[model samples]
Target: MTIKEFKLPDVGEGVAEGELVSWLVAPGDRVEEDQPVAEVETDKALVEVPSSYDGVVEELFAEEGQMVPVGDVIISFRVDEEGDGGGGATATDAEPADAQPDSPASDGSEPEPDAGEAGDDGADAEPDTPSGRTFAPPSARRLARELGVDVAAVDGSGPGGRVTEADVRAHAEGDAGSADADAADAPEPRPAPTPTDTGSDGRKSAVSKRDAGGSAASSATAAGGPEPAGRETTLATPATRKVARDRGVDLDDVPTDETRDGEAFVTADHVRAYADAVESAAEPTPEPGPTDDAPEPAPAGGAPETATASEATTASGDETVPYRGVRRTIGKQMERSKFTAPHVTHHDTAEVDSLVDAREDLKPTAEAEGVKLTYMPFVMKAIVAGLKRHPYLNSELREDDEEIVLKGDYNLGIAVATDAGLMVPVVESVDEKGLFELAEEVNDLAARARERKLKPAEMKGGTFTITNFGAIGGEYATPIINYPETAILGLGAIEERPVVRDGEVVPAPTLPLSLSIDHRVVDGAIAAEFANTVMEHLENPLLLLNE
Candidate 1:
């Protein structure tokens, strides 16, 4: 059999490496060519890595959390013959497929972490460690360290004598203050701590067992160790732990949302909801005693009290959204841009009464050309005119070569906001495209970008970026430069505002604009000149026609 090693391709231009998010097909799994073998997250987007050869998967070279560089061998495929490899594995210039099947791939849907993933993500289930400790998940080990509890002293509550998250919490709390301590002190009746029944506080867990879908058992009963049958353990995820910690809520006290394998599971939502309820209940509400004619309804157990937001809607509240794929990528890119570029923002207002009227005049002409003309087309034209004069703003400083590279071609990056994150789809050779062409392309690109159908190539080779923040109702921001590019322009809402015309105040359509430039490549004078020239073109649509 011929073993073929498939290297991770450079999914996008200039992307050095990508994080191995998950393996879609594990070793020994049969797969066809182009069937995605793994999911990788680049700095720009989360993409699937398809198998280039049709064969059985031999080895997976990269772990889920490891960052593999471009051209690095990620997987090996074993084929029966030397030349009979290729079948259907080809990546074309089309919209990328969704990454992790469970994960919606940056579509703003945050799914719960799978129990299997949790093992690798937090559980350090290695048989032995350098610290001479038994197997436990990383989270449980961390909690043990935090509470000054020795893992060696605590009993394992997980399957196969594995240490669990709750085992450590209960150990640290002293397991009902320890039986010896109870004997030494006052003889107060206290329940002995059991892996299956007691909570972190060392009490018979008060969390309802009915919520735990399984018969009064535990979440990890499938692993099967020595856990009791009727007792249920309180289970909280890492995110829930953080929320409980921040709010000073006991993990044991937070009511269970559900039970996984008889273990009462409390999620981050459960903690937040419980905290909100507690806080709301603490507030003093003045209530007039039951009126003579009408009396307030009472529950079978007690009197009716004020309704808390949590009680009314248990699901509505703060959520712990994990920054994993594209959303995390955007954050890192923004941080790099903000920190690397010495930013200088200049805000200005342009009276665009004539430009608005010009768009209205050419609406029919644009429609006849199969394009719906918008102010963005006029803005693009005006930007190109300004860039032609102030070429420095449309250039980059090659720090590696220690020289300035002025781009002759105007490739504009139009920042489109989507539910996932802020994405910029590039429009190449803007100077060559007419108003109708620009309008159609912009419309197409924006629509596709929102739907996440734009290819990686469509987002590349940008000379300058323009973001229409006004569309989302905002004005004047220190827009971060799209890295490697020298400047970014921000457009605010174009609304009717009072402006001075011929020494007299009059209501006119005004557009607010903000420009952010990289001080290392662009001087204040050049930035000011570019801003003013762009505004001039915007104010007088005829100026763009002349250009």
Candidate 2:
């Protein structure tokens, strides 16, 4: 049998190492080529690693909590001889190969300790240590060392020789404490005692003297054992642990009430509760009203009419959800875009009465062609035509080395509001597609995006963005600038409004357009020109078809 080693592959841009989040297959389990074997988390995203060879598993070289560098061996598999030994394998009755001297057994056996006492005598360690002693997961060892507990004393409950943080904490609080108490009570050789201070009455106080003598000894004992009492205990899930780490919360000190299998498993709710408690404890209360200058009591049947904003925000029955996935991504990106780009908004109302009539005129043709014509299609077409006429606006801005870069390609972004969040999917080569084709493509992209089936590439490389908040009811808004691009156009709701035609006021369908442009890239004059171009297109809808 031949062994094939599967190395970790680079999953994202410039990533060197990834944490093994989970493994789908195990040693002795048959797997096929291109089958998912493990899920790895890079700095950017979580990606699954497919097996490179079809074979019976020979060994798993990387542990779940371990960070495996790109191109490093992660797993190996044994394949049959006639399988061409490339990336294919077949079952065999042969015995597994001998494990490496320092490797843990593939049968999910705990690694034995490198023969030595709990402390001291490092040279007396053994060569083949069990997974339990030497292979404690990253979080487990970190918790153990931080809490002054020995990892070797903890029993791991994770599958396939894995140790979790809970195991370490449980061992510290339960077994380790009892074991240390028993060891202290044992009849060991006593050390010489130091002298103590006497009280003012010339008599040694029983408790004070005992404490004085034990202080130094206690320090030494603590160095060799668990931490001193009264430190807070924290229990949380792996995901919650990650959140705590990101928020700079000391997981060892987070107070929790829930326990899983005798170990604390803190949920997101527990962390928030702990945070609230801490905030409340730290905040100072206002001083009580003065008695001499006693304020008058409230009138009978009278109370405060309104609650404070904080109280109102917190008192509602609505649930608070921590943002994840696309929403979280949108929040971060929008924040970055807003902070980086100096946005300037220009708002104006366009008389869309003619445009409405023009859309009605083309409705029959659009319906016959299996397309639903909307004002957006004409607006998009007009924008494309204007971009062709004024090429500078259809570009991206790059301020690197004190020089500005304006890209030429027109990759327009259409912001589609989904149930999850607002997603802006790019429509490439917008100047090329006709109105019907643009409508079809836009519909397909928006539908696919809401379904979460849009590729990452589809969400990027936008030169300009349009958000039709008008469809939902908005007049004009200072829309946030989509970063790397100079501008975003907000389309407000079309409503009947007074318009001046031939020096006479009359009711007409008017559309409010709010254009936000990056001041760093485009000046106010340029922004006005772009907005005017869009307004011209909407004011004369037939211009799009004529162009």
Candidate 3:
């Protein structure tokens, strides 16, 4: 058998690295080329990483929750010339060396997920993972943390005992408080898995370069006595502490499962494992009854009645969110855009009564064809026309070569704000598509973007960007240009306001527009002209037919 290493490919443009969210395939699993083996979270979205080779999993190079740099070997596969790599629904689901998949039934296979047929997967399914590690999606784990439920403690009813989002929600709603509380109050140092010799992410492992700890017996104290008073409570690395804090766990309450230098030692892995146990074992919390005479319960850390939340935050009582994924990526991009491009915003409003009437007239016709008509299609069509007229608005400046690049393709990126962050799913060749086609594509892409299903290529190769801030209720504000793109058009709320159309102050629907441009590429006059052209197309939808 020849071992071949599979490195993490760049999932998104300029994405330096990604967090290994979860391993869809375990060691010893048979996998095919292009089969999804891992879920990697890049700055843009949660992407399913496909394997580049057909082989049996040899060794997993990185663990979940680790931020691996791009081009780092994530997993190794053993490709035997004579070996059958045809992936079948394995009886074992390719369990790792020491870990076993959870069994919903006495039989060691996963429960059937037939939605129509109810099986023993709901209440009876419990996490029977004997190994310390648990296998669940990163999103499921995050939901568990927010619900204060432990994912490892929940019985997974999913395929191969995989915990699903529904499992976490069910765990949070039902059986939320259980024996897990005692374990959470008494977390311990976790035995570290064997460290990989791959590139480092600059995080510390709880297990130092020495003997570590692990065992079922280590989780609890001896039944005969209380924990030894003289024994140390917790000793951990800084990275472990930071990881624990990020997981909303307190290290002081965590039990020291392993002793180092006559003291209990803990690692970042331990804190995470303990958190899993805590949330999984959690049962439904009972609602509190009111005490009329009693004062309201104080939140975490003591705060004065007069102090504002900002004051309390300054008083060392705030949760620190590690900026590494999409948020971090957005920060870097925004910084580069702000500093590199001298941004000048032009705000304007157009009384779009005719446009509104045209959309209203087309609504029924579109609905009859089973399509929903939104203002976005009109806005996109207008923008494409404007781009053609003022090419500078849809271009990029190459400083290194001191040249401007005007793209022939009209790949319009629509900025969709999701829970993950701002994701721009591009609509390629917008000029070639009609209003209905554009509307369908825009809706589909936006839907998929929020669900984190948009492929890496769907977000790339954009000439200009559009951000519809009006959907969230704002009118006329400066918008940042997506880097490498010369301009971004922000649409504000469309509402009826008194307008002087033909010198008459009658009620008319007005649409607010904010055009932000890279001053280096487009001056104020060019931006204003582009905005006017867009408004003209919008006001007279018949004019769009001329394009």
Q: Global lDDT for candidate 2?
A: 0.59
Per-residue lDDT of candidate 1, residues 154-259 (tens digit): 6787876677979877865665465443222322111111223211222222221223343212322333422322333454433345465556555565555355
Candidate 2 Cα outliers beyond 4 Å, as residue runs: 1-320, 323-325
Worst 10 contiguous positions by lDDT, candidate 2: 190-199
Ranking by TM-score: 3, 1, 2
TM-score of each: 0.55, 0.51, 0.64
- At residue 477, candidate 1 shows an lDDT of 80
Would you give me the overall lDDT of model 3? 0.68
Model 1 C-alpha lDDT versus the unseen true structure? 0.64
Tell me the tens digit of each residue's lDDT in model 3 across 463-506: 99999999999898889889889999999989988888688898
Worst lDDT 10-window in candidate 3: 98-107
- Tens digit per residue, CA lDDT, model 2, 49-112: 7887755555555545656789887776665444243221121222212211121222222122
Residue 200 miss distance in model 2 (angstroms): 67
Please give the CA lDDT of all the candidate structures. Answer: 0.64, 0.59, 0.68
